[model samples]
Each structure stands twice: as C-alpha cells, then as structure tokens.
Target chain A: MTAGPPSLTQDEVSSSPTRCRILATAERFFREIGYQKTTVADIAKTLGMSPANVYRFFDSKKSINEAVVERLIGEVETLISRVADRPGLSASERMREIILALHRDSIERITAHPRIHEMVEAGMTESWEVCSHHVERITAVLARVIAEGKAAGEFRVADPAHAAGCIQTAILRYCHPVLIVRCPGDVAPPIDGMIDFLLGGLRAG
Target chain B: MTAGPPSLTQDEVSSSPTRCRILATAERFFREIGYQKTTVADIAKTLGMSPANVYRFFDSKKSINEAVVERLIGEVETLISRVADRPGLSASERMREIILALHRDSIERITAHPRIHEMVEAGMTESWEVCSHHVERITAVLARVIAEGKAAGEFRVADPAHAAGCIQTAILRYCHPVLIVRCPGDVAPPIDGMIDFLLGGLRAG
Candidate 1:
C-alpha cells in the first residue's frame, strides 16, 4: 500500500506527528502480539504505509524498539528529575520520593501496556546502549541527590557516586521490570521496610 | 548413537563420578558451542551414551541446565554458609566476607567461562525456576546473617528478612553474572564501601 498520500512532503513523513504515530502503532501491535512476533512490515501495514516509508523515520526495527524504550525511560527520568528538584525537602526525603516515584511510574506503565515490559527485557539482554544510558541517567540523578545530602551534612557518604550506585543496585528487584516479576512474592517482604533499611544505611555516620 | 552400556545401573548413573563426568562434559560443550547450541544429543554423544540415557539422569535439557546452575550456586552457598558459621567474627564482618566472596566467585566464573554467563542470561529470561531457587537460597543465607546480627545488637533492622532481600538486590550488579558485564566500570565502586554503607545503615538506630 502507498504511504497515505503522494502529496505528503518528505519532511512531513519525518515530522513529530509521523514519529509519534509510528510508536503508538508499534506499541499497540507489541501489546497485542508481543515484540518478537511483531515486525516492521506489520507496523507499516497497520499504519497503511509502505515499510520503506517507515524506514525513513526509523533506520531499523531495532531502532524502533530502542526509540520505544528511550521514550519509556525518558518519561521516568522526567518524573525523577521533578522529585529531585523539589524544594524544601531534605536530600534523604527527596531520594525516598524519587525512588518511590520511579517504582510507581514504572509499574503503572508496564501494567497498562505489558509490551513495554517485554521491550525492556529484550533491551537488557541485547546490551542496548539506550538501556544503559537510561540506567546511567537514573544513577546520575541519585548521585546528585546524594552529593547534595553530603554537602548539606545530612549523610556521611564517603563517595556519593558509589553510594548512589549501591542504592540503585539494592533496590533493583523493585525497580527492574523483569526482576519485579522474577523475585518471589508468596513470602512478600515489605518494600517500605527495605526503603527504611536503605535510608538508614545512607544516614550520616 | 547408542547407550554406553545397557548394564549401567540407575545407582551407577546417580553416583558421584558419573554425575561429575556428565557435568564436566556439558560444561565443556557449553563453553565451546554455547548453551543454546549444545543439545542433549550432543552432550550424550560426547559422553558415549544415548540421549535417553542422559535423560535417565537429568530428565530434560532444562534439567541439565538447572543442575549446572545449581552446581555453580551450590559453591557460593557453601562459601556463604562457611562465612556465616565462622566463630569469633562479628555479624557485620561475616556479611562483608559473604558479599565479597559472592562478587569474586561470580566474576571469576563468568570471566573464566563466558558461556555460563550466557546460560544465566538465558535462564533469567526463560523464567527458569532453578535460577529463582538459587536467588532464594542466597537471599535466605543473607537473611540468616542479618537475623544473627539483629540478635546480637549488631544491627537495628526491624525485619531481617526484608533487609536481606534489599541487600541481595543492592549487590545484584556485583553478584549477577550478566549485570557484572552490563553496568559501567570506568568508575568501579568498591564493594567494601557499599558493605560499609549497608553496615552503617543496619547499625542500631
């Protein structure tokens, strides 16, 4: 099938609306049929465009997946930054809110659209730079809050970066989409208690 | 092509030497050809036995993988228990050793034989119960140590089990075979500092 209308400019195909349409369509297919089963041709067919036109926006199928993941991570990163930038809260309090906010946002996204969860799982195994970049940005935000805490004499961390990394690692099962599913639940541990433990660990010596 | 010996009794197949032989052969093939590439038939061929005979011992390719994983996790469990059971060392000290031992052992195994790393990566995504069991056992060991510390007033954790879960998650990057390869390394955070951070957090409030 032809890409909608021949009158549509090449620039229009590369515009934000086109890009957004592609992602929305891809996400729907991913949810309905799963990431591995869904193909670029399928996405294009559903979008009523030729696969070649879809390529003009996303270089490869992998790029489309990466873009999808980037979009997901970007949303979380924005929420985290807002929590970090909130005024009047202590660094420890801010960090707690940031962590909780991250958990809430991720769980909500994955629950509403399970396909994004599958996309993340694939990204992790493939060693995608997008996933790594997402992790790096999150860790950086945590470290900044940590460094702020250290500056304010709220924490006695010798290395804010290291502490941030350790904290991220500690809360991974709660934060990581796959681990959240894999870790046992029959003997559920209180996440709030775990958070308190982590916060306690971060307290000034 | 054929069974090594029809006369080989069930008792003999279950014997330590036979089990060791099969594992060694499987590990060698896994390393050489990769986990997905190595088949039960291939393993049996290497052992001069029929795939049926191989199944007689391990039940399935998935079971064989589980045994291999169990063998790896068993080594770490032994080490963690030894550290926990050691007399005279404070609870915090035992925990430090346990975490360090886990980090060192996992990194060494993955580095020496990268193929097992791939096996683990696959196991995680495939939702292998054996992998989940391995994580559970490790977390249990950590919980026991935390409980001992709490009893001795070495830690102020309200919930030892929860603390253990969080600790395992926090150090997952250092402990998980695949994550060790994924997380950034130029700014390698010292595991000791993290142990200290965890210890400080667990200290009497």
Candidate 2:
C-alpha cells in the first residue's frame, strides 16, 4: 500500500486529548498536595473520568508523573534553547543568561509552590530517565554555546562537551530543585560569581 | 579568687566517658539500622543505660546525631587540612589531593554502608548548624590552600575565599552525600576533569 501520510500508530491513537487532561489534573494534584499523596483515583475524580480510563492512557501513577515531569522539562529546555539562540548576544552573555534563567526558574517554582519539590524528588527517584534526559538536553545547549565560543576565539577550552558538563555540574546548588529548596542558606557563592568563575575557566589558555 | 588551677565546669564534668560511649553506640546504630529507625531507646538499650541517662548527656536523639555528625565532619576536616599542609607539594597539588580525599571519603562511606546517608539526611534536617559548620570548616580549609596558591604565584584568582567557595560548590556532585548516593549515574564530568577545569579558572588571568 502506498503511504498516504503514514497512519498514526496504536500508541499515538490512544494518546488522545483525554491523556492531556489526565496529566494536567495529575500535575495540579502533585503541585498542590504532593506526589506521594496524589493517587490515580484522585486524578480520575478531578478529571471527571474513571480510574480505568486514566489507566488506559497511563499504566500507573508513576508513568503519569513521568509525563508531567517530561512536560516541565520541555518548558525549561525550550527556555534555555531560546536563550541559546538569541540574536546579538555573545557566547559569554548567552551562557550567563542561561545559567540565570535556570536559577530563576527553579527559585520561582519553589517559591510559587514549595511542595513542587516533592514532585521533582519523586521524578528523580522513580523516573530517573526523565531527569537524566533533561540534564543531557541542558548540557547539549551549553555545549552548543561553548562550541560557538571556541570557534569565535571567545573561549580556549579543549573539550566543549566536557566543559559544558563541568559548568552544569558546578551550578547544581543554584539550579537543582532539591538543593534550592533544601539549602536556602546560600551555601554556594552568588550565581553571578559562579558564572564568572566558569567563564574564566572557558577563557583560560 | 586566686589564679589557681581552673575547675571543670558542670558542662565539662557531664561530658564524660559515658557521653563518648553513647555517641559511639548511636553512630553504629545510625550506620546499621539507619537514622530514623534508631531511636533514643535503641541507643540506650545498646549502651546498657536508661533513656534518662542518655538524655543527661544528649537531650535528644537529634543532639546525639549532631554530635555524631560533628565527629564525622572533624575527621573529614582533619584529612583535608593535612592535605593542605603537606610541605613539599605545590598549592595546585594540595588542592587536587584535598578534593580527591573528599571524594574518596564520601565514596568509601557510602560504599561501606549505604544506610549512612540516612544519618546525614537527619543531620541536614534536624541539625543544620552542625552541617553548616562543617561546610564552613571545609570552605576555610580550601580557602587556605587557595590563598597560599595565590601568594606563591601559582594561581591568579583575585579573591581566594570566593574562589574556594566556587571550587567546593563545583565539586558537590562528587562530594555531597545526598547527591552522591541519590544520583549514581555520573551525570557530571569525572572528578579529575572537573578539578582541571576549576584549576584552569584559578590559573586564568
């Protein structure tokens, strides 16, 4: 049979608007109550659907949480990608903005809903691949900026990918959700100072 | 009063051999059964003392945990200080050794008893001062090495204290007990590469 616009697979067909509604309701419950307390029945009740219907879309609450976490990661990745591709900004400026954005995003989320950390923690424990994917995507964005800087003679790093990993790891105190919420004492240096130190590393001969 | 030999105060008198035995037993319980499960009763039972007797030394399990955490911190600080004070090594070498010692210590503790993180988590939650003091002491040791490196013209950082903070913060993934235990995926760069990057920042103009 000639391909007339490849047919939607069974998975895609089942991934309907109902799935989006379930995730939206589940995310609200996770943010408001907590990941541990939010049950599949609670999500189903909130969405005006049966628990079986919710299960048709997501096999378990853990899977639903993974989807919610994926959505949140997508938002952050999009924000960073926009910063990375912004016009008229040098690589250093872009790098600084990207780090700040990550910090601000984390702080805003925690401030807005302190229990949001519970969801993220659950994601880290139960759905590590989702968390790991976010890290890899973020590192890729940083590596892209470093590669551009190296080509433009703005940085002197030997391995942009490794340097990007170093930068991401270095700023975990500022950006990681668990850290930002748990350690509010500003144990690390201010974000600007950290970015400066990382930039110095990139610029070193 | 005459300037005679000083008398031991009540606090000093009470901090006796019994106190040391209590702490030693509590540390073992924390390591084996985990912190939350090891109550004041368990500690008292292990040391063949009444709960009230244990309380005479430490008012609560939290205080005992604080003391245990303090002792653990002391060991790490002593290790790092020795690395910092080695006579023949350059400042960079000392810094590298210090960081490696920290990583090795954390890895060893976790590898030997994964439940040890429970005690640390309790310390972070219940005895933040003990934890904060440990951070300050570690930072102080790192700052001394950085300061010496700057004076010897082996590094070019402007503020050794701030640079030391940055270095400690940068290596958290490898050193922080919670992060090391929770995220075992090696998401960050290897420790040696991370140290080289931080050293590059220090040596940069």
Among the numbered candidates, top TM-score falls to 2
Per-prediction CA RMSD (Å): 4.7, 5.9
What value does the lDDT take at residue A188 in candidate 2?
79
**C-alpha TM-score for every candidate:** 0.80, 0.94
Q: Which ten residues in a row have the lowest lDDT in candidate 2 chain A?
A: A1-10
**Candidate 1 DockQ, CA atoms:** 0.37
Off-target runs (Cα >4 Å) in candidate 1 are A1-15, A82-94, A125-127, A143-154, A158-162, A182-188, B1-13, B82-93, B121-129, B140-154, B158-161, B181-190
lDDT of 2 by residue, B1-205 (tens): 5443345556764678888899899999999999989999988888887787777677788988998999999999999999999999999999999999999999999999899998988888777778788888999999999999999999999999899999999999999888887785667888999999999999983
Candidate 1: docking tier: acceptable
- Tens digit of per-residue lDDT, candidate 1, span A121-160: 7676563677768868888999999999989988887878
Q: What's the DockQ for every one of the candidates?
A: 0.37, 0.60
Error of 1 at B102 (Å): 1.2
Best by DockQ: 2
Each model's chain A TM-score:
0.87, 0.93
User: What is the TM-score (0 to 1) of candidate 1?
Assistant: 0.80
Tell me the spans in candidate 2 whose CA falls farther than 4 Å from its real position.
A1-9, A12-14, B1-9, B12-14
